[model samples]
Target: MSDLRDLYQELILDHTKRPRNFGQLATANRKAEGFNPLCGDRVTVHLELDGDTVREIHFEGSGCAISTASASLMTEAIKGLRVEDARALFEQVHKLVTGASGPNGGGPSLGKLVVLAGVRDYPIRVKCASLPWHTLCAALSGGDETVTTE
Candidate 1:
């Protein structure tokens, strides 16, 4: 368990230092911003949808390591997925990080994203970790208003 935790930590740090898909997408058709007032984390998610599938996704922001890494990992996870699948993933990840998952455990395969589940141990930081996901949700729903974790 300790080894697994260390690996997760390393992965988070790697993503934080070199976030994947971190930039603006010139071809983006949808975009949304998110803010976590408690931690002062802000992020914007951009998406290019080819029909119902995400052809490309990107994000740009300055935030805590958790927030940045979550955005990075999220972009990687949802890039090729259909919009509905991405939304479902958001729900699963929300449950995982909020400790709201059922006894069956992690509640489906979140792959590398499971690393973020550790944030649940730190109540306040949960908002930090989930900030990007909320922003992504807003983008998917075509909401222009900024999502806030208040």
Candidate 2:
């Protein structure tokens, strides 16, 4: 378990220093901004949907390691998935970060996002980590306003 935690930590740090898909999507058709007022983490999620499939996804923002990594991993996870699948993935990730004891013996089946499971231990940091996800939700729903984790 300690080794797994270490790997998670390393993965988070790696994403923090160099997040994946960390830029604006010039061709994005959907976009939403997110902010975690408690932790001051801000993020913007951009998506390009072709029919029901996510043709592309991207994000730009400034926040803690968990926030950045969550956004990065989210892009990787949701690409090529249908809108419904993306929403399901979002729910899975939300459950993971919210400390829900999932089927994997308390660990959610979020794949790379499992690294963020530890964030639940830090209540405040959970907001930081979830900011981008909520933004993604808003973007999917065609929301134009900024989403806030109040």
Candidate 1: list runs displaced more than 4 Å. Answer: 1-8, 102-108
Report the C-alpha lDDT of model 1 over 1-150, residue by residue, as the tens digit. 885463359899999999999999999999999998776789999999999999999999999888999999999999999999999999999998888985333644799888888887777788888899999999999999999997
Question: Candidate 2 clash total?
Answer: 0
Local lDDT at 87 for model 1: 93
So what's the TM-score on candidate 1?
Answer: 0.92
Per-residue lDDT of model 2, residues 28-127, tens digit only: 9999999877777889999998989889999998987778988998899898999998898888888878877553423435677888877877776777
Q: Any idea what lDDT model 1 has? A: 0.89
TM-score per prediction, in order, is 0.92, 0.90
Worst 10 residues of 1 by lDDT: 101-110
lDDT for each candidate structure: 0.89, 0.84
Give residue 82's error in model 2 in angstroms.
0.4
RMSD of each: 2.3, 2.6
